[model samples]
Target: MKTFTIKDNVKKFLTVLFWILIWQVVSLFTEEILFVSPFKVLPKIFENLGDLNFYQNLLSTVLKVSWGFILGLIAALFLGGLSYRFKVFQELISPLILFLKSVPVVSFIMLAWLFLSPQGIPVLISFIIVVPIVYLNFYEGLSRVDKSYLNMAEVFNVGLWKKVEYIYLPSVRGYLLSAVELSIGMAWKSGLAAEVITFPEFGLGALIYNSKLYLDTVNLFAYTIMAVVSCYILEKGVLYIIRRILK
Candidate 1:
């Protein structure tokens, strides 16, 4: 076990080092102000880390996106349940889900900006991106439930809670987690994109736009890194909480 762990760590370290080396070589060859080295960007990111406004912006964006994600998840679960119980609801909403899936993100951002306050745009965008994903995954999960277990439940006259706990939940766990992971990334991306277009007061998207306007490549890269890291941390944290609860 120790040997395997050590080997895995070594492999990951080597992989990261290889990519860093490639980046360094590319930066050296380009010698462009727009493509600053990773070292330069790292310091800028650290400097920004000290700013109070940075945390405020990060927290605000997180709150908006998280709220949106939660709302969408609940709606999806409710709607998916309804769809599972009734063929009529499923047929009615199928086209709407398809339309949401087909529409462009920028179009949604633009349309939402016209109707929603700047602060609301991110939440709306996050919801738009997350809903269809959760709906589809949950619907599939419901459809894939073992008929044998359902039949057994019916035969035994299982209560709603028991059926949910022992049958539906266990069957849907994988789908729920998978949808959540995918939606986390999508929510962040769509939310930030909406913020950038709307120029929300305190958002990572606004920071990135400002950086670009001034041609601050280092800060641009730093903000991009921060956004990616934030998304990753949120995704892992949510997944951990879900796993703990389910366990």
Candidate 2:
């Protein structure tokens, strides 16, 4: 297993290196003003990393998106549970869920900007993108709970908590975890897109926007790398927590 893992890691590194080489070749061929070599971009990224404000901006962006994501997840779970329990409520909410899922993120961001402050836009956008996903996944999971297991629970006169623990929860754990993983990436992407458009004072999105305004290709690439890295780290962290809880 150890040998296989090591080989896998090496393969992944080689794949990444191969892509970077391809990118370098493409940039060289284009010789365009907007394109910066990955090597040059890496040094600029490191330079930005040394700045204290870089960390602050990264942290602030993460916090805003995460706060909205958690709140949205809680709201989704509550509503999904209620919908599962009540047929009328489900009927009423189904359209709204469908509408939210269908609307473009940019449309939501633009509409939200009218009523919300710049700082609030990212949170709202993140919430809008995440909530529907969670609601749908949880609702489906709840509905798909095995009838036999429920009947068995009834026969055993299992308490509400035990029924949830042994039946409902385990059945839904995979769905819930998948929803979380999917929403984390969506929240980050939508939130950052909101920041770029809204130009919040301290955010990765704002950094990207400013880089664009100045025609700073290296800075733009650096900020893009930062956003991607942040998203990757956040997803891994959320998955780690999910694993711990399921364990």
Of the candidates shown, which would achieve the greatest lDDT relative to the real structure? 2
The collision pairs in model 1 are none
Worst 10 residues of 1 by lDDT: 29-38
RMSD in order of candidates? 1.2, 1.0
Give the distance in Å from residue 175's predicted Cα in candidate 1 to where it truly belongs. 0.8
Against the true structure, what is each candidate's TM-score?
Answer: 0.96, 0.97
Q: For residue 177, what is the lDDT in candidate 2? A: 92
Q: Give one digit per residue, the lDDT tens place, for model 1 in 1-247.
A: 9999999999999998898788888889775566889888888889999999999999989999999999998898998999999999999999989988899999998898788999999998899888999999999999999999999999999999898889998988899899999998999999988888888899999998898889888888899999999999999998888777655
The global Cα lDDT (0 to 1) of model 1 is 0.90
For TM-score, the strongest prediction is 2
Q: What is the Cα-based lDDT of residue 214 in candidate 2?
A: 90
**Clashing pairs counted in every model:** 0, 0
- Give lDDT: candidate 2, residue 158: 93
